[model samples]
Target: MADDASFPAGSEILLLEDDLPLRKRLAAHLRLHGAEVTEALRLEEARRLLRDLRFDFAVVDLHLPDGEVLDLLREGAFSENTGVVVMTAFGGVKQAVEAMRLGAGDYLTKPFEPDQLGVAFSRCRWNRRATRRDEHRSAEPGAGAEELFFGQSLAAVRTQLDTIIAAERRLERRLPPVLIEGETGTGKSALARWLHQNGPRADRPFVSVNCAALPDTLAESELFGHERGAFTDAKRARIGLFEAADGGTLFLDEIASLSPGTQAKVLTAIEEGTIRRLGGTREVQVDARVVTASNRPLDDLVAQGSFREDLYHRLNLLRVVLAPLRDRGTDILPLAHHLLARIAARHRLRGLTITRDGEARLLAQTWRGNVRELAHEIERAVIFSPGPELDFATLGGAPIPSAGNWRNPAWRLPESGFSLETAVNEFIADALRETGNNVSAAARRLGVTREFLRYRLSGAKEPSAPPDANHPGG
Candidate 1:
């Protein structure tokens, strides 16, 4: 069949099909329409090509001589800059369902029209390009940080920011104790710093301490200072963090970790505005604003009799709850791009960008670790990225099974004579099947090295092969 003449020119394609005649025909048709085509007869060859070159989209056959195209799908091989269209001659409802579950961008039955393939590829490319543009704009500093934090959601982050700003304006006399609650790595510390810098105490010192890090025995002296010879290590008088932060702000991270004795001292200091040095009679007044943060709900801790009720009420005056990254879906792409730019700048690279595939992979992840994990991943990608633009390979691979699937398998395990090795092998095989034999994606889902997977595959008897006509490689 003739290719679609209306298809855009110069699109790059990675074509994987073992059948020489079909591969040749598709390449010729695509080339006639001004596309650059790379052909691979084997899944391994396609993976190698993908590692070295970036493609606008990929066309993968469902079955291969040695394995299934689903293996490639599982590996997230097309996760970077390419959209994928899976073709199957032996296609069944089960196979199509599994292919889509494994992250196939599009699936087609055999004997499909060339024009249909062109349209699918074009749609994927267009969407990816548009997403990249949107990410770039949002990642630019000051373009969407406010919108990122406030406008996109009905979450109280906007009101919280406004409250913080108002608190800063009123910081000269007395600033209420500010309590921030969030899961770890949700930018609680960053928000605290922003409040500190933007508030009236901007000129004063902003001291921070992790209450959880203080030794139970030394917590009192750490926060209220100690006179010489007060304890075994008290060789001389030393100023506590509270005294050091006078006229500024004191951020106590993980405040819920404090011991009951320490909590009492902290409550006293907050209420009385005075703390006496250990072994000293004189009470020194402290004038620092207090900002406390905890990863868990302090009220829950109070209910459990772990955290002090009085301290909880005292710190709850101006509360701000930072949303976890996964909960803030609108911010994911923007954050990814922002982190990419920051990583690029830090690495001294110019005009670094995320490819459409890269952004899609980023969006596909659950980001259980939140912004911190995303930032770390981007930093790694920047270091390993081959070109100015981050590609699919840089993403390490698309997450094989969606988090939900991996957490809750739709299928049941075999009941009889189950062995750990057998179970593992079965799981790997199922994952490969689900992902259309995508190795990288299988590895990701299995949480093992691709090399390890290769080793395991080599030891096992060859899996049942699909028909050879449309299968890519043997």
Candidate 2:
């Protein structure tokens, strides 16, 4: 396998196994398969290798000399590109489940055939390559910036854009305090910028302050101007973000992270449209629109008593919920192309394109890190992609399944034998894979209509397949 020209040339892999014979055999096998293999006898060595080198995949023994393989998975030592396959002599259903939950790409029992390892490697490699291609496609030039959201579903896109646009328009009227809620990397800041740019106060300054980044002691002075000599370090009178954004817009990012006292000041400013500088008795009337963003639901925070209900209601006047990347399938491709073009232009590199397989991979995964993850992946691909075409093998990991990992045989199948429902689901999955997950194509190939295929897909009584190999769609 080491001398096989068909295998990926120069790809690096990390093999973590305490068994010396097994380690050597795997290393030789991978090297023969055209991969550069690094061996680790202990978990510490594995960690050191991960820190020092970028590996495309890792074959880990469930138990190590110093620790368990699950630790590495939990710690995210492997970049999203690194595929992890856990093998153990004592492998059981429980161990596999635990490993999968920790993000292992696949699980193999001890004494398995070397060919099985090869298959796992090949599958992961292919998945990574497909992901890279999608990332390249997403960063293409002149693509709308809206691709920051994932998804290809037209309804999803329209609904999100409508909410964004509506919020923007509403913010123009009274500059009512606005709140945005979504998971991390869901483009909350981007939406905030859009509101600032499109709102009535577009010409005014757009000031942003991250509540989480500021010290609680400085937050008050940061939001409201501080007079000289107000504090020990006060050297000169300083205008706060609210004052700076007067006649403009103030974006408060990570508002949920603000301290209670700071939240009180914020509430006061929003309610009165006036701020009193620290050490100054007089109030400074400021006309600024406030846009606050939080990763958590403000209602939930309010209920938990971490966030103030009054403040929540004030900011919630014009609320917009940014959908997670997984929900915006329609935007995935466009975003990927847009990001690629921007990256290529920024780096002065030749343009890159995505293949059909690449598109399919992009649309198939759940984007937990949302647009930011997609952006990083695309940027990395632009740096490593050979020539003008982005290949799928470079992506480095399988697409996370959108429906979650309910399909693993250990989890979904009955012990005695395959259930009738599971059999039907397996058949449909095979058909879908064969047709590259194109509903119409799969339906035609399977001698069924597209609608029928959709029905079966939605109603199938089996665990959903994992996303089509963690391609760079999101």
Candidate 3:
């Protein structure tokens, strides 16, 4: 028997091939790897199995006894969650492309080794994950794109994650749930993904969902799945994230936002290793490792009676708390540079560097939004700067002044005082010049209205009253 590490126990697979010898060989290989293989030698048999069962993956031959597998593909016989690998005797670019267009995750030509099935299955899993991720991003625009950066400040976090990964390797099944607590924009989702990718089940699907974004009415169905007639709009049966992430990790971001009832269901799923669909009576056993994250601490939510204490305790078994960005001052500079490099590559820019003053400004601000905010700041500078060095474009308010300049807050007035009007005019002019003389852009850089900027540029005599930078017609 092959090592069971390749497939989780109870992993369901539908194998369709006309050649009895090849079908038996593939089925034997899959069974040895811990998958429960449902063999079908004809298209009709495959169709019947697909109609009655939900498979994690499907291996289909292009030409079958009754019909071409492409016919089933065209009819959408497989769910979006099912990873399909199409095998063909006649290898052609057109056939491969058509299979892929019809939702095949991978294409394999004939005369391949049985060992190669593992690689093909891995690729199929990746394709399924990518498709789901793209669908999620489409629903939630402006999702975080910041890469995970573990620096000195995050050493503790890294160590804890390493320990968890080590533990996962030692276990054969049902990895314990992980709880990640952090402030918003602290890269909780990214951390969860990193844990999944580094864990023993890296080859399995990594499913992610934002509980906070799920409507209260549909939260249960979304997490546990639903039957065809589960609800008003549940026109068809659908496997939820738990089943989609079977034998892998399911990341639930902002888990505290789920209603008490849904929280109870989640707790049950964790404890029993099974979930009953919203309208389902039969409890479907699943082996997904749940990794939940919350911007607000679950302890607080439990205390407030908004979350279930039992669920909190269950997930609290393996917990890691991420420090806020303001508390991790040492990581600011290095993380910024890391993000800058990625952003520059994405924009196809060359030789982009943050100026010394820009570094000072980045370090000065208390990043309330954490790494996500830092990435945006760097991206803004990259997009707006015309030179090789970034000027921060207005990221940290006004520019830093020289040691002896009047702009310094600690600077005391000399025996000969400076003109207040001259100082304000110079400030406005500097903003205009920095933004390439665009009034609107300059106004934004100065945190003022365009009207205020225009009025300041008019060179009018100073009014007795203070100027209102926010006024519409300043």
Candidate 4:
């Protein structure tokens, strides 16, 4: 298995190529780079090796003597942890996409340089880790469905994050650790992901874990790693989060839960750029950017002696805070609408909306769970809504009666201005459709006279007042 980060050095690799001279040269190159290479000249020989031994990575040609490599890919011949890089002379966009979709980590058009092979293997490693991360996220409940939404109220926080990303790009190596503090369910994990996706290593892996979820006995082994026979039930050696996230970001949510002993090791890893696996003699180097989040303020934890003061100071250098949802008064409605849209689309529902009363009910809540609570409320409303309007009957209050007034005092114009004319037209059109194009009914629904509605529908200039107060259906 490959313990070293980035390249394939100090790992086992399988080199599969049909051409004799090319195979020998490639094997020698990989071996020179400190990798243990096993060479196979045919598909049958490769299959035999694969069945008999476990390899960390495989560099295989597309067309083998006995069969095509796609056969093996479709059959899932490679282990889940084995990173595979395919080389082909007849490579195209479609072929590459197909190969990756099947199971291959990376695709390469052949007649390439030896250096490119190393780079491809590096990409393969990242791709494999990323795929595993995505699969794990998908398997968890309510994961990947919560999109990051930073509305007008979060504008300053967004600006600060952008500044941090800019600073990160300018530095060549060793990105500084970032600390995110917020209440539970305030989207701290989402924010960490946003930072990683927008930073210099967007193409690299982003590994995430909840420190609070790790049991006390396994915390150190999970974060650092464990060698075979390190403890009871230690079946095999494994790479930890730091090594898996090499050259990218590692997000630790609820980091305050780590024990003092584990915290010291984390600090050492961050400061010294190395970690020693449990029951292992040599220290392995890792360069994963650590981004940690805490539900409670670390300052309080440090004061109580629950957290290490030195580690707190180190992470406090680059910090961003997320305000609770209740404090973001103006952001409630827009955020609810965004959540509504996503929930509706996922259930194959359309034209879903929040009534004025529903909007009022949403704004009145304390939102103790922040964005997470809001999302659940929206999903519940979608499930119970009898029509297009979400009245939020689950909110436990009688619906507020409409006063036939369209102008809402609570509605504030967004920082980015909108097209008033287009908005008005869309509202009128929607009313007309609901009323079966009955002009009088649409006018009544809009709290306007029939004459005014017809005038606007004709695309005429705004009338100073009603043309005829006594007009029919006025």
| Number of the top-ranking candidate, with TM-score as the measure | 4
- Candidate 3 per-residue lDDT, tens place, 1-474, comes to 112324545668999988999989999988988788999889898888988887778998888768888899899888655778888876465786799998898888887888888777777765654555465557767645346899877887899999999998999588899999999988898899889878898777777888988999988877887866579997655667776677787889999989889998888888999988766656677788999999998898888988889999999999999887777754788998999999999999989998877876776778889888989888988888878898685865546655354243322343234588777788788877877888887776566676566667786543556556665432
Instruction: Summarize candidate 1's per-residue lDDT along 308-361 as a digit string, tens digits.
Output: 999899999788887666666545777777777776776899988877667667
Candidate 4 local lDDT, 57-123, one digit each (tens): 8888888779988888787677554678888886464766677788787877878777677777767
Ranking by TM-score: 4, 3, 2, 1
Q: Each prediction's Cα RMSD?
A: 35.7, 30.2, 13.6, 11.1
The deviation in Å at residue 321 for candidate 2 is 0.7
What is the descending lDDT order?
Answer: 4, 3, 1, 2
After aligning candidate 1 to the native by TM-score, how far in Å is the CA of 314 from where it should be?
A: 0.7
* Best-fitting candidate, scored by lDDT: 4
Better candidate number, 2 or 3, judged by lDDT: 3
Q: Model 2, range 1-474, lDDT digits (tens) per residue?
A: 111123445657888888899889888988887778888889998888887776657888888778887888788777654677888776375877798777666778878877787667655544443443344335433323332333333344446546665775765534578788899998888777776665566665666667887788888887785755679987645556675566677789899898988898889888888777786655656667888999999899999999989899888877777767676534677888888888888899874887655655565556679878878877877787776766455544343333444232212222234367667677679778976887766655455555556767888433254333323222
Where does the lowest 10-residue lDDT sum fall in candidate 1? 408-417
- Candidates' lDDT values, in order? 0.71, 0.70, 0.79, 0.80
**Which candidate would rank higher by TM-score, 2 or 3?**
3
TM-score of each: 0.52, 0.53, 0.62, 0.64
Once fitted onto the true fold, the runs of candidate 2 whose alpha carbons sit more than 4 angstroms away are 1-173, 397-474
Q: Candidate 1: TM-score? A: 0.52
